[model samples]
Target: MKKIVIAPDKFKGSLSGIEFCNAVERGIKKQIENVTIVKLPLADGGDGTVDALKFYTGGKLIAAAVHDPLLRPIQARYLYAENEMLAFIEMAEASGVRLLKNNELNPLETSTYGTGELILDAINRGAKHILLGIGGSATNDAGMGMACALGFRFFDAENNLLEGRGKDLNRLTTIDTSMVNTELRNIKFEVACDVDNPLFGPKGAAPVYAPQKGATKRVVEELDAGLRNFNEKVETQFGKNLQNIAGAGAAGGLGAGCVLFLNAELKSGTELIKSIANFDEQVKDADWIVTGEGKFDEQTFSGKVIKGVLDSRTNQQLAVFCGLSELTAEQIAAHKIDYLAEIIQQASGVEDSIKNAGKYLEEAAAQFAANGIVSK
Candidate 1:
């Protein structure tokens, strides 16, 4: 192929996507000689969203002082494209579950208020459209904490203002939008989400996700009840029923909250990334498309980067590579993945594979080009 498109996700504990691209490109260049290589590193609306978009738009990283999930002050960042007036905010940066320690992770007491602060900062910087990546959150307050940062006051039956937490939901009687930052209404919010869970049922936010964030069964029930109360209160106050919205459970009900309060549009993470990347324009005349991840197991069949890339483009000329893959031959045949390479298979052992991921990636790319023996 005269032109090749190399797009990949991060290797988890090893290299970032861009690092993979560079290593692969160097390797490919060693064999391909004169091919054109287009590098596009992708993310699934989670940890790597900012860097992915930054690569796409050449956006500047804007840092703001915000609170972590535990309400501690910290500096977090988002991608800002000044010319496009788009602010890319990953909620995880400000209130991600990873920010908490094992002993500190408590869904009952966490908050998304920091995310709200980031949004406010973006607005102050003249961002007209906000692209919020809602993933890896530490709170289950149904976005109440975020709303608080935007000046939406929550009150108990006694009309007493309440500090936000998952446990605070049961005490909330009504919301005060009269004090909400009116500026939020003018900003268009597009949320990047991948889950389809509802707000408060069996497959809803708390029951499905709270335990992973360190909630006990009792806390899970409490958070679920809190979401129901918040949902009912929202419907009563705003004439909007958000209980059944697909993706309502993403990031601890931040999806539902943004839709209900910020009038945000929810989109699959891949779809949103594709729009910003505009890969169609970049791949129109490409002779080959390469994509991969750390693991290509059954989960890869879902909506992760490799699947996203395959779905986004035809597979006739697509080449697949991964650190480790467990796809059956039938599955590989079904996806029409003709050119495939596994880096782990080329290593001495699993530990050696991960430790020398970049070396193996470069070698794999070169082997795919020079030898054409990827064992597809």
Candidate 2:
């Protein structure tokens, strides 16, 4: 009996990580009998982290009342693991760009208030460790809402409480940490992030990502100015300049916010997932390994799940690898992946490719299992 591990990240709009594993399993079983398949979902601290953790922790999903990026009331779900007293949070659930209509993409007016509400709920539920995945954020409020929820007061130059939006960050002049949730002081916060852009500058939050969230030239400029002001104010209050910190601009500056305000430790999402998932132990005796994501471009080599999988394999001498949708021959060759295939190549059109992604994946897995001979 061959032991195979199928670990894959969510295929974005097409398939979830679990779904991908199932598809792969179906394919493998068709080609080989009595094959042991281990499914481990993966995420890069972005949209699918909570779901991935749910598989590893057997956590319960809890729904909470929160606000959207525009401060609209909404309900979002997060995961809680009673055994570990851990809460898994995906920032996208509360402030993702997907929540807004195409015409309503205004980064300046958006806020991360709902994300804060989720965190508060986790704390209230007696969670001692928070696994915060910061990705796909619709707001660039530098974590003001989260800070507010934890008892930090943001004030304007006139000494009035600042209202909302990243634009209001410019007016922020004071931060009162006295009311900060005492529970947070004793809790562990592990922030899963990947980007290294600073909080404010040419390559910072506003200029680089705010436009994608619906900022125009005018709004980007204003938001940039506002973020600069907020950074200066934060420096005055905390004696630290977060403007140039790597990963500070992740999740519309949520990375900086968590670090400066909540004392959260920032780490690569891939590393965090590997540790929490115990991927090494899972793959220790596996005969073959499969890993991929939506797109396997040059980016996959840099801090993505594929790289984590490769790194976790202690005995690199073993023939271990997987397949992906969009990988160049050269890129695949560089990784030394044992079996390489794609679903899009076999589909008729874009819609069909997406719709039949699972089927295609299954077919690819079957073919690989039949012909993917690994030499030790």
Among all candidates shown, the one with the greatest lDDT = 1
Q: In model 2, which residue pairs have backbone atoms overlapping below 3 Å?
A: 196-247
lDDT tens per residue, model 1, 79-185 = 89998889999899998988999899899999999999999999999999999998888889888899899998999999989877788888999998888888888
lDDT of each: 0.87, 0.83
Write down the TM-score of every candidate. Answer: 0.94, 0.90
Q: Candidate 1, overall lDDT?
A: 0.87
Query: lDDT, candidate 1, residue 343?
Result: 89
Q: What are the per-model C-alpha RMSD values against the true structure? A: 2.2, 2.6
lDDT of 1 at 172: 91
The TM-score measured for candidate 2 stands at: 0.90
